[model samples]
Target: MPTDQIDIERYHQLALQKQKEHRLFLATLKRKAPKNLDKIVQEVHTEVFSEIDCTKCANCCRTLGPLFTEADITRIAKHFRMKLPVFEEAFLKTDEDGDKIFQSMPCPFLGEDNLCSIYDVRPKACREFPHTDRKKIYQINNLTLKNTLFCPAAYLFVEKLRERV
Candidate 1:
């Protein structure tokens, strides 16, 4: 791994240590996020990402599955030149919550080097994973909090936010 790359093991360990603080921080964020929170977060997102490369650490793709929407199914199916049902049968299964997800972890579309096989037509959820730079930064505090456990960028974003806010 690169020196600047986040080690998933260390990230999780630190995340556990900071869990309570993170929860309290998020609660405080929900109560009153600064007006420029989104812009500041976007800047942090960009800065942190400069040193963090997703290709080196696809923990999100290797761990949590993306929610596949109907459009995602259609687009991916079309990209594969297969019938939708055929694609679904081959690559998808509904989770306990009835949400369509990839049938396996280390997502089938993930290449050996962590590149996405179907990058262009990947699900909307995949496109938005981590979501640190999204608008209305305060609105997604809960989701952001959850992501910190699995996404290094989110972890870094929240850590950086702590200093700025």
Candidate 2:
């Protein structure tokens, strides 16, 4: 990988590729979710994190637009004391067909070091990011494909999890 040209745009592309691999792995998990997602998530995270440095690959926060729910939108809007419509117009957009997503990939709120500008009040999806680390994540099996390739942490996490079962 070329590290020199990693502006937001390049990071965005790298994020897409990571998401792709995650999706591929998720398909295999559909057949079985190993019985213990928490421990599995932890073990895999241990392995994955050893290989990841969010500072270096902020691709997840930078590229993926979280699928914030109605409640999520309201909470975020209230956090900023901005009306929902205003917040939506300024930062969010309905993804291609309809689902709500951020207007830009490599979120505008990303800082010089790729930190989230709204960390404390980030959307629900943002808080549980890489949902692979979430407890009983198997409950979200319905959403695996979309989320699988959505972040590098998720991609590597899923790979390690799959290896266990």
Candidate 3:
């Protein structure tokens, strides 16, 4: 199992690099200025994802809660071979807005290596981790900022984008 602690110097360096990249991306977006931002964001997401690897930074699993949908519950429940009710009682609960989420911080499924224990059958939200590719990308400004600590890639993406703008 890999340790969760990232080298402070290396982590900071990478974070700064990512920030720079985000600025560049934003600058390009402003210059080219896509017809529809939603589609453009997805395209940029695909391109950025091709360049940046998430496995190298599993901060999402370490921080933040994934808003679980009903399907997330049923599939994850099946992954454990337990009824949805049993799984919910064991590892999940409804938050203030009726969204099902993990009981506490640091996902329970996160293994020592920063890999999800049930990666293949993980929740829909987990499958869509680092959801920069989605249409409502701008709406998740809060999430993108929060991901800075957990995902160096996100920091780089945003930083580079800002530069482009």
Best by lDDT: 1
Better of 2 and 3 by lDDT: 2
Candidate 2 residues 1-165, lDDT tens each?
447323444434554665655555555555566677578777787787777666666767766777878988898789889999999999888977788898878877789776777888787877776666667666675465455444556555665676775
Report the backbone clash tally of model 3.
18
Model 3 per-residue lDDT tens digits across residues 9-68? 465566655655544454555466656777656666676787666655666776677888
* Candidate 2, position 85, lDDT: 98
lDDT of 1: 0.88
Clashes of 1: 0
Residue 93 deviation, candidate 3, in Å? 1.9
Query: Which of the two candidates, 1 or 3, achieves a greater lDDT against the reference?
Result: 1
Using all chains and alpha carbons, the TM-scores for the candidates as numbered come to: 0.94, 0.67, 0.70
Clashing residue pairs, candidate 1? none
Candidate order by lDDT, decreasing, is: 1, 2, 3
Residue 18 in candidate 3, Cα distance off native in Å? 11
The predicted structure with the larger lDDT, 1 or 2, is: 1
